[model samples]
Structure formats: structure tokens, C-alpha cells
Target: MFQPLAELPPPALGEREWLLECHCARPVTDLLKAQGWDVVADLDCNVHCSSPDRRVYVGLLPESQEAARGELWHIHVTDNSGTRTWRQTFGADTPAQAIAGFLAALIAFPARYCTCA
Candidate 1:
């Protein structure tokens, strides 16, 4: 059987300034917000979602001219009070995949973060 956390509302259009070649910020933030998370999009195009002492951040790294020459997405989670942090990067071709990876990471390490109010 399958169960959802909540009956989330549909995401609003043009609500946040999404990056041009984004692979992980916009949709992830929208999902987070729908799940009752406090999310913010920053000037650097990073989406930050937090709950109490736990924080999750998603950022996009476009194809560059340097050595790391590919499009990448980074997701990080930090538990301020627990003094722990987890970060992972993925060579994702889409924003939804990157967000799914990040969510999977969080699910794999739930004790490392705070989920309270």
C-alpha cells in the first residue's frame, strides 16, 4: 500500500525566481513548501528549507569551463544542535531527480536532523 504524508496543494506558478538552467532548486522548494516547510530562495539561486534545528539546502552548479566540467546538483543537510552535517552531489539531468536524491538521503539519515517545530 502507498501512503502520502499529506494531501499537498498544487504549486503556484511563477512564485519564485527560478534559475535559467536549474536542476534542483525551484521544484524542490515548491514540494518542501507544500509539505509545510519554511523555504526561501536566495540570490545565489539556492533554495533553503528548514525546520527547527534541521536545515536542507539545494544548489545548482552549471557546466563550467574548469576541471569539474559538468552540470551538477548539490544537496546539504545540517542539524545545528546535533552538530552534524551531510552533503552529497549528483550528476542529475533534471531538478526532480536531484530533489528525489536529496529526499532519499534525508530519509536514510533521519536521526541526524530535527523535524520538530
Candidate 2:
């Protein structure tokens, strides 16, 4: 069953920025946001280990179905706009609980950042 976004624990990383790395992207995004931090953007890739095809992406704004890439990450995991900065790029499907916990910490302590979607 999908973990309801609203039920997502408060940011686990004790910060506001998070990078969702998983096959189940949207749902995870929902869960993180439910914790309090807003999702600025996401990027799904076609493969791992940076390629010319490798590029920073924004999944939060998928223009169409073609936007679904294999690997994804938040454009600015560490938005320095605020007091703190976050940066992370990793593989998805990282055990739900661990991810949830990381996100919770981030939410509890957030820095200044743009209002990304």
C-alpha cells in the first residue's frame, strides 16, 4: 500500500531540502511534502552513473509522459537561499523508513529557498 503523504513523519534529516531517489517517485514526493517541506522540483534519469545523457533534472515539472526518466533527483537538494544548504544525489528505492526519517529531519530545520514546485 502507498504510504499516505499526510502520514509522512516530520522531516527526518532535521533540514528542509530532500532528494527523492526511488522507482516510486511521486508517492515519495507526496510523503515528504506532507511532512512540511515543499517539493521544489524533481528529475528522473534514463540510467545511472552520469552520461552525456546525464544531466540535472526537475521532475516536479514533467511536461509529458516522456518526462519519466529512470533516475531522478531534486534540482536543488541544497538550496542555499536560506540559512542552511542541502545537496544529495543517490539511487532511489532506499528503504522507505530511512528515507522518511531523513526527510523528517530536514523539515524540522529548514533554510531559505525559492518557492519551487
Candidate 3:
């Protein structure tokens, strides 16, 4: 059984380093899966999770893209017609603990009124 999001242990420094370099998506993907999101992984090891109105993507992106420079995490919520209504990104140097905290909060609350959702 999956552990509750609030109870999940934060990833250690070494683990975070490994995840950043290897693009391992299990940690985040598993948490999203437990929250009823559908997850898919590509050959490049990028992970994508989607719910009815939201999508989360985690990957090692090329630094060349202006929006993706130093950012590996991407999240967005879309409208019924598929237009993105909200979006956020986290930089490469962001701590795993911070990411976990954000995700925990996100899971605990509904996204209806919040831009961070």
C-alpha cells in the first residue's frame, strides 16, 4: 500500500542528486499515482501525470529553452477545451524536501481557487 503524502519521507541529498542526474521519475510519479492521477513514462525517462484538469511533468530538460532553463519540473491545469489555465515550474537546484512539501500541500487541497495548483 502507498503511504500517505504527508507521511512520506523527504528524499535525502544523495537521492536528490541521483534523481536530478538520472531523471528517475518514480518518487514523484508514485506519489501522484497514489493521488489518483494517471502516469506515463517516455523512453527518455520523463514522467507525465494527468488528472481530469491537471497535468504534471518531471524530466531533465535541455537548458537552452528559455522557460526550461534550470527548471526540470512542470505543472499545468487545463480547461475543458485544452487551454492551460495555470502553470508553474521549479528550478533544478530546488531541494527535494521543498518539492515534496509543495506536492503534499497540492494533494491536500483542491486547485479550484489557487494558482499554485
For model 2, the stretches where C-alpha displacement exceeds 4 angstroms are 1-22, 36-71, 75-84, 111-117
The total of clashing pairs for model 1 equals 1
Tell how far residue 100 is off in model 3, in angstroms. 3.0
lDDT of 2 at 67: 40
Residue 84 in candidate 1 has what lDDT?
A: 35
Ranking by TM-score: 3, 1, 2
Best candidate according to TM-score = 3
Worst 10 residues of 3 by lDDT: 55-64
Given candidate 3, what's the lDDT at residue 24? Answer: 46
On lDDT, who's better, 1 or 3? 3
Give lDDT for model 3: 0.62
**Error in Å for residue 30 of model 1:** 2.0
Q: List the residue pairs that clash in candidate 1.
A: 23-95
Please say which candidate is ahead in TM-score: 2 or 3. 3
| Colliding pairs, model 3 | none
